[model samples]
Target: MKIKSAVFVKGVVGPDQILNDGKHKIAFIGRSNVGKSSVINSLLGKKGLVKSSSTPGKTKEVNFFLVNDKIYFVDLPGYGFAKISMQAREKLRNLILWYLTSPEIEHSRIVLIIDAKVGPTKLDQEMIDVLKDFGHDFVVIANKSDKLKRNSRINQLKIIREQTGKEVILYSSKTTEGKNDVFSKIFE
Candidate 1:
């Protein structure tokens, strides 16, 4: 699964706008500012390929990126942005739910990102439960691993695995840590 080319395809605000061709899709879902875009850019071995923002809620649409023209990496909108209006928040919630449940999307795998230092939150738990109920296989990527103490990082992975019953790959976009393992699991 060598990545020959990674290109941004488009952004969708609704289910009808999503590109669906039965191609294998890998979706990235997480709270706002969880380093989802950064991970994508880093994976492609390029900076700024997928826009990343310092502010939360900057990404409010589902972004589809075509990878090697063989599969798709969908960047689902981030959740838990307190500053957004209730209406907008609800819309985002619906969009995410639609992406996950839509038969057309049919993602082959999902990557749930979480801030390693902060650990998992209530919203994260809810997302995990939703994936479980949907019967979608997913892997958690604990981002910002470079910000955590070594011992604490290891313990956090343990805690996350125990809580979700899924293995979590520790990662840091800054250091490119865990990048190989993450891609391997997806293409494996």
Candidate 2:
């Protein structure tokens, strides 16, 4: 289950034909600066495929990437702590909520990314609650695991697991740690 090919498809902000295109979608979501784009790029084994940024909230729309010509890897906007205006941030928040709760769209899986060193935050918990309420299958990815020391990494993973109530995979987009584990979970 390797990603042999990937290409950016299109970005949408509201209901559209792409939502019902019958392609299995794997959505990546998390708070701002959680490295969601970097994680997606790492999973695809491409550096610039997903357009990562140091600043948060760069992803303003629901960007879809066609992976292996079979499934769609949806890069959703980061939820919290963006430099954007209140109205813009609210729109992004609503867009994320709609995508997650919409009945017309079927997600094969959702990847909830959290900062490894920071653990899960308040917004992450809200997203988790929404996922639970909607009965969506999801996995937690603790990105930036490389930033933590060995003992800190263990403790952080434990804390994240306890908080998220889901197995948290320690991932490093820089070192590609846990890349195989992530791939298995995403493609399983």
Top-TM-score candidate index: 2
* Residue pair clashes in candidate 1: none
lDDT of 1 by residue, 54-118 (tens): 98887778888898987888887789898989999888988988888776666788999989888
The candidate that achieves the highest lDDT relative to the unseen native structure: 2
> Could you tell me how far off, in angstroms, the CA of residue 43 lies in candidate 2 after the best superposition?
0.8
- C-alpha lDDT (0 to 100) for residue 36 of candidate 1: 91
Clashing pairs for predicted structure model 2, backbone only = none
Task: Give candidate 2's root-mean-square deviation (CA, Å).
Answer: 1.0
| CA lDDT for candidate 2 | 0.91
Residue runs of model 1 more than 4 Å from their true location after superposition: none
Candidate 2 Cα outliers beyond 4 Å, as residue runs? none
Writing each residue's lDDT as its tens digit, candidate 2 over 46-108 gives 889888898888888899999999899999999986578999889999999999999999899
* Whole-model lDDT values for every prediction: 0.85, 0.91
How much does each candidate deviate from the true structure in C-alpha RMSD? 1.4, 1.0
Clash number by candidate, in order: 0, 0
